[model samples]
Target: MRLANRVRELRARFRLSQHELAEQIEVSRQTIALIERGDYSPSVVIALKMAQLFKEPVEMIFYLEEEQQ
Candidate 1:
Protein backbone atom coordinates (compact mmCIF):
# COMPACT_ATOMS: atom_id res chain seq x y z
CA MET A 1 0.00 0.00 0.00
CA ARG A 2 1.05 3.53 -0.69
CA LEU A 3 0.48 6.45 1.61
CA ALA A 4 -1.97 9.03 0.30
CA ASN A 5 -3.19 12.32 1.72
CA ARG A 6 -5.73 15.07 1.27
CA VAL A 7 -3.28 17.80 2.26
CA ARG A 8 -3.53 19.66 -1.05
CA GLU A 9 -7.30 19.67 -0.91
CA LEU A 10 -7.36 20.72 2.70
CA ARG A 11 -4.78 23.38 2.11
CA ALA A 12 -6.84 24.79 -0.73
CA ARG A 13 -9.93 24.74 1.44
CA PHE A 14 -8.06 26.74 4.06
CA ARG A 15 -6.90 29.18 1.36
CA LEU A 16 -3.26 28.48 2.12
CA SER A 17 -0.37 28.14 -0.25
CA GLN A 18 2.02 25.27 0.28
CA HIS A 19 4.51 27.70 1.75
CA GLU A 20 1.93 29.04 4.17
CA LEU A 21 0.94 25.57 5.32
CA ALA A 22 4.57 24.58 5.62
CA GLU A 23 5.27 27.63 7.75
CA GLN A 24 2.38 26.92 10.05
CA ILE A 25 3.41 23.27 10.30
CA GLU A 26 7.05 24.20 10.78
CA VAL A 27 8.36 22.46 7.70
CA SER A 28 9.90 23.51 4.42
CA ARG A 29 7.77 24.23 1.36
CA GLN A 30 9.54 21.39 -0.44
CA THR A 31 8.46 19.02 2.30
CA ILE A 32 4.86 20.10 1.86
CA ALA A 33 5.20 19.66 -1.91
CA LEU A 34 6.64 16.20 -1.43
CA ILE A 35 3.83 15.18 0.88
CA GLU A 36 1.14 16.48 -1.46
CA ARG A 37 2.72 14.62 -4.34
CA GLY A 38 2.87 11.42 -2.29
CA ASP A 39 6.62 11.31 -2.76
CA TYR A 40 7.29 11.47 0.98
CA SER A 41 5.60 10.24 4.11
CA PRO A 42 5.96 12.74 6.91
CA SER A 43 6.92 11.88 10.46
CA VAL A 44 4.21 11.41 13.07
CA VAL A 45 4.97 14.82 14.54
CA ILE A 46 4.45 16.41 11.17
CA ALA A 47 1.23 14.52 10.61
CA LEU A 48 -0.08 15.61 14.00
CA LYS A 49 0.84 19.19 13.29
CA MET A 50 -1.07 19.07 10.00
CA ALA A 51 -4.02 17.47 11.73
CA GLN A 52 -4.10 20.27 14.25
CA LEU A 53 -3.83 22.98 11.62
CA PHE A 54 -6.51 21.47 9.42
CA LYS A 55 -8.71 20.73 12.42
CA GLU A 56 -9.09 17.18 11.14
CA PRO A 57 -8.06 13.80 12.41
CA VAL A 58 -4.84 12.30 11.12
CA GLU A 59 -6.74 9.41 9.60
CA MET A 60 -8.88 11.84 7.67
CA ILE A 61 -5.85 13.54 6.23
CA PHE A 62 -3.79 10.47 5.42
CA TYR A 63 -4.50 6.88 4.55
CA LEU A 64 -3.12 3.82 2.80
CA GLU A 65 -4.11 3.31 -0.78
CA GLU A 66 -3.60 -0.04 -2.38
CA GLU A 67 -0.97 0.31 -5.04
CA GLN A 68 -2.06 -0.76 -8.46
CA GLN A 69 -0.01 -3.66 -9.65
Candidate 2:
Protein backbone atom coordinates (compact mmCIF):
# COMPACT_ATOMS: atom_id res chain seq x y z
CA MET A 1 0.00 0.00 0.00
CA ARG A 2 1.04 3.58 -0.56
CA LEU A 3 0.14 6.77 1.22
CA ALA A 4 -2.15 9.15 -0.55
CA ASN A 5 -3.04 12.75 0.26
CA ARG A 6 -5.23 15.70 -0.65
CA VAL A 7 -2.68 18.42 -0.04
CA ARG A 8 -2.98 19.96 -3.46
CA GLU A 9 -6.76 19.97 -3.42
CA LEU A 10 -6.95 21.46 0.03
CA ARG A 11 -4.26 23.99 -0.79
CA ALA A 12 -6.31 25.09 -3.77
CA ARG A 13 -9.47 25.14 -1.69
CA PHE A 14 -7.69 27.49 0.69
CA ARG A 15 -6.34 29.50 -2.23
CA LEU A 16 -2.80 29.11 -0.97
CA SER A 17 0.26 28.92 -3.17
CA GLN A 18 2.83 26.26 -2.39
CA HIS A 19 5.20 28.92 -1.13
CA GLU A 20 2.54 30.42 1.09
CA LEU A 21 1.57 27.07 2.51
CA ALA A 22 5.19 26.19 3.07
CA GLU A 23 5.69 29.38 5.07
CA GLN A 24 2.65 28.70 7.14
CA ILE A 25 3.72 25.11 7.75
CA GLU A 26 7.38 25.99 8.34
CA VAL A 27 8.61 23.90 5.42
CA SER A 28 10.28 24.57 2.11
CA ARG A 29 8.24 25.12 -1.05
CA GLN A 30 9.93 22.05 -2.46
CA THR A 31 8.69 20.10 0.55
CA ILE A 32 5.16 21.24 -0.12
CA ALA A 33 5.50 20.35 -3.76
CA LEU A 34 6.90 16.98 -2.90
CA ILE A 35 4.08 16.30 -0.49
CA GLU A 36 1.50 17.36 -3.04
CA ARG A 37 3.03 15.08 -5.60
CA GLY A 38 3.07 12.16 -3.18
CA ASP A 39 6.81 11.87 -3.64
CA TYR A 40 7.54 12.54 0.02
CA SER A 41 5.86 11.78 3.29
CA PRO A 42 5.93 14.39 6.02
CA SER A 43 6.75 13.77 9.63
CA VAL A 44 4.02 13.85 12.28
CA VAL A 45 4.91 17.37 13.40
CA ILE A 46 4.72 18.71 9.90
CA ALA A 47 1.47 16.86 9.27
CA LEU A 48 -0.10 18.37 12.36
CA LYS A 49 1.06 21.83 11.33
CA MET A 50 -0.56 21.39 7.93
CA ALA A 51 -3.74 20.06 9.51
CA GLN A 52 -3.90 23.09 11.77
CA LEU A 53 -3.29 25.51 8.93
CA PHE A 54 -5.89 23.86 6.70
CA LYS A 55 -8.35 23.44 9.57
CA GLU A 56 -8.52 19.73 8.79
CA PRO A 57 -7.76 16.50 10.54
CA VAL A 58 -4.56 14.72 9.63
CA GLU A 59 -6.60 11.69 8.57
CA MET A 60 -8.67 13.89 6.29
CA ILE A 61 -5.54 15.10 4.52
CA PHE A 62 -3.67 11.78 4.32
CA TYR A 63 -4.72 8.18 3.92
CA LEU A 64 -3.63 4.78 2.68
CA GLU A 65 -4.33 3.32 -0.73
CA GLU A 66 -3.46 0.18 -2.64
CA GLU A 67 -0.29 0.66 -4.62
CA GLN A 68 -0.41 0.15 -8.37
CA GLN A 69 1.34 -3.02 -9.43
- TM-score, per-candidate, Cα-based: 0.97, 0.96
TM-score of model 1 (CA atoms): 0.97
Alpha-carbon runs more than 4 Å astray in model 2: none
Model 1 C-alpha lDDT per residue in residues 1-69, reported as the tens digit of each score: 999999999999999999899899899999999999999999999999999999999999999999999
Scored by CA lDDT, what does every candidate get? Answer: 0.97, 0.93
Q: Write the per-residue lDDT of candidate 2 for residues 1-69, one digit (tens) a residue.
A: 988999999999999999999998888999999988899999999999988988999999999999998
Best TM-score among the predictions, by candidate number: 1
- Cα lDDT, model 2, residue 61: 96
lDDT accuracy of residue 23 in candidate 2: 91
